[model samples]
Target chain A: MTTATIIQSLASGLLMGLLYGLVAVGLALIFGLMDVTNFAHGEFLMLAMYMTFFLFAFFAIDPLLAAPLVGAAMFVFGAVAYLLVVRFAMRAKANIGMVQIFTTFGLAILMRGLAQYFFTPDYRSINVSWLGGKTISLGGVFLPVPQLVGALVSLAAFGALYFFIKKTDFGRALEATREDAGAVALVGIDKNKVFALGWGLGGALVGLAGAVMAMFFYIYPDVGASFALIAYVTVALGGFGSVFGAFAGGIIVGLVEASTALILPPSLKSVGIYAVYLLVVFIRPRGLFGSI
Target chain B: MDDAHSKRRLRDLIVAAVLTCIAALVPLFVKDVYVQNIMVLTLMYAALSQAWNILGGYCGQISLGHALYFGLGAYTTVLLFTKFGVLPWFGMLGGGLISAVIAMALGYPTFRLRGHYFVIATIVIAEIGFLLFHNWDWAGAALGIDIPVRGDSWAKFQFTRSKLPYYYFALVFCCVAWLVTWWLENSKWGYWWRAVKDNPEAAESLGVVVFNSKMGAAAVSAFLTAIGGAFYAMFVSYIDPESVMTFQFSLLMALPAVLGGIGTLWGPVLGAVILIPLTELTRSFIGGSGRGVDLILYGTVIVVISLARPEGLIGLFAKRRKEVAR
Candidate 1:
């Protein structure tokens, strides 16, 4: 292969990988703190995409400009979801796995159904004057402007999140709760509030990723279904609850996906990804960075 | 006490006899082709879900990848019949054995993972299966395979113009699956499985070979589910990876057992009876314009039941009976 071609593929893969990492961090955080997988996590991403679309369609605002608004809306949605569905499932004395699984699975179907009802299952995309149909030439390779911006936004979001978790007292409390909820409670921290905040932050992160993606990707009711499995694989490969691990895992998965496409048939590219996932699961269940 | 026990046994026998007779006779009375079709579908789901219950409910290992086995069984039988002219009867048995072996192979490595990790593994494995089949030309790839239409022949397991034979075939399979579950519920394996499910570490401490017991359950479950898959291949006379190996198919197989009562012997049957008809009626009444209403209803039901009554409908009945006795 030519060096230029290889550079181009790697550049695109790196950009895509950043967004994938953003998609998985929310799932990892929620799982680490709440101990629920949130099967409907992808649907939340779908919601954000739709939210971005509506904001653009109704007010003629650019999706990038409205990303924070969508993120804030999703934060409230996530907190409320935790209070209503997840808390009750956690409280159940028997069959905790069954209850938790179906609750989120049900929510996923519910959200998809509601989206279809409202949006009619048609694929939607945002077309901004600045973002659409533009590319930047980097050395000898070309990079799509929308994708580049999305990747930068994801990196910024990741950096901000890392700073918050590492530097802030609330972030420390969140981490403590994840490590040992009973111990955190003994130290006068409210475990419930910490969990709710985790959900909110997780939701906001995914929502921002969704808005960024909406600038370039197709938007639909079932759009989340495609990304949901990939995000789950990222979370597991990253070691369940570790945000940095999820980010690293995402890049690894993206690289594997893009590089394999050069060798395997398009249909079999996913097979390669799944094979990697199975290997990681069998060989290292704790993931690359997970402690337990 | 002896007299009461005998009387209860006699009553159970009578109930079983009556149900069997009704199952045999109902298709004859239902003249509508649509109703018979629904019955066939309901019975197929009943068998498939019962097979799932063996692993997911009794053993407490939730596999969202059961479609892998189901598709394996279907493809095995279809390929053998189309290539070598093997009778579907023997092909069905071959399919089941293949599925059982595959399940055992997957189960050994996966059963080590607990809870959600196990669940994720199942999904990934199933996706792998889908990808492989979607690209494999011998299995017909994405275009799928169609069994050549043959006139009504018991040897080929193809029926022309009569839904009755297919209905009876499905009913028999469903009954067999139910009987196996009933037998397992009373057997030593059943006790071992319950122990493992309730607390694996404790069960191991008490001399149970936890891995072996789980593998045994997985084999039996895969075997029965494969038979249902083979039957489905003949019933539909068409097979595709998208239809048979998708995550949606896996979830649908598990839904009935969850809805009726996961661990109960007759939960799958009860759940199939309720769900299949509900799906059909919604499809007819709401039609195409109301595409997602049925799914919305199903999601609502599942969420409400999981939240308010994790034990399901049968569990509610059992609870009432205990209260009355007290």
Candidate 2:
């Protein structure tokens, strides 16, 4: 109601928006690389959270420490998924687009089932990670420490991603492959290998987001379902296949979500996000930064 | 080729009629309530999926948000029947009209978005509807509606004693949807839709009203899907936001068409028949443990089928038939 409260909420919203960007950027990255939407990108997050949880639960490692481990593990997972599933999906001679959507969707379901089978579908959360239950006040606005750290981590990841895409040899190869997969092959790059690595890179990005999310969010089998839509919205709102657009989209979505919560009931908060998404796409069609 | 095509159309009609006759007699021979229940579900899904095929398959506008119309149909019927004492039959028509109008209205802006943008718009719109219904108190909010038992009569559309009538209604519904698809397949609109699907630019150049074709597909698809939702409300005799309108409902409606063969005439029916029973059996047998075995099997089948036979199992039959003729 007051400007002070508004400022505080907006601050928290900005942080959450950064994490949303992190969650969505991988989807944007993969879509940019190849026109396939994972549809299970959220499940990949769920998996990473579980990985972080297990590492914390058994090995006594903190989630902060577990982030890199989860990222590394998820890289392999993402690459293997591409090789085993997406590779076949890409080759589908008919209804290739639907095939891609459904295959990744199927994988998401299978992962959820497996999670339920092994993890018992019980909601688990790390109660005592160093930053889990802590909060900090900055200029009369209080922010959850986990989300703050998550925002910081997201910025760091984006920075690294910028450099990775703009500076590194692999990043250049990735850019080259994304521009024209067939032509990349003529230039002696293994197209499949590049794609698999792209998938891995995308996977690792979401993995980082998942680790931070595990600090505060409940870890469960179906947890991915809720956020997956938002991730999709963020990706599309920024314009599909543009990673920076995803980041911008995530910030816009988060701010809108926060402002909507201020006006509407919390339950109806998503209406604001969906409305903004529709409004944006309606006006621009391709999204804010989408290619013509 | 034209003669053969006409001959095939006649044979298709005959085959459909014969299949309907055979299906009607199925409950008479098999008296298990559980089996009958699954049969009812299969038929309902067949009808729903058929409606979805009109837009998603035939028109190549893949919508994963049919649940909005389904939930709307259900809500309209239950609200009208419970509050004003209107019969569900009239309610079904009313719901269908509302959904069709809404589809066209939403389609006005959304149809411009190509590919994922359009698909996600449908999802977001449906989600907005779901959230509103979830929070709307007068409409029973998230708890949903429970249809009171007025009587066991065809006029009332409620039969507690036996599901036979419901089964027959579902059968007719399925047949009508299939027949509609069959009819539209050869119509000017149908050809226009296919042309739009294959290549909208080319179709546009060929004088097809691409946007209108998509709008038409949306209206019809939403209308039919709404009818299915109304029937589902009556059949379940209870309606809730979660049950009728969710992301899962949209996916479930689309699954049969996808599994059987998208855009094909028999795809929805064939997919529903094969998938509905398998899901029911799996849920009862292995899913009872809460370990998600049913989901595992279901997911595996989806992945394998999409990979192995993206065209659908109907393609297998078509291939075999061609081989036999050869």
lDDT value, residue A186 of candidate 1: 95
Most lDDT-accurate candidate: 2
Residue A21, model 1: lDDT of 91
Model 2, residue pairs in steric clash: none
DockQ of 2: 0.86
lDDT of 2 by residue, B1-326 (tens): 39989999999999999999999999999899999999999999999999999999999999999999999999999999998999999999999999999999999999999999999999999999999999999999988878999989988899999999999999999999999999999999999999999999999999999999999999999999999999999999999899999988899889999989999999998999998999999999999999988888988998998899899879999999999999
Write down the worst ten-residue block by lDDT for model 1 chain B.
B8-17
Q: Which candidate ranks first by TM-score, i.e. highest?
A: 2
> DockQ of each model against the real complex?
0.67, 0.86
Mark the 10 consecutive residues where model 2 chain B has the least summed lDDT: B1-10
> Which parts of model 1 are misplaced by more than 4 Å?
A186-188, B1-17
Model 1: lDDT equals 0.87
lDDT of 1 by residue, A78-116 (tens): 989888888888887667778888889988988888888
How well does candidate 2 score on lDDT at residue B35?
Answer: 92
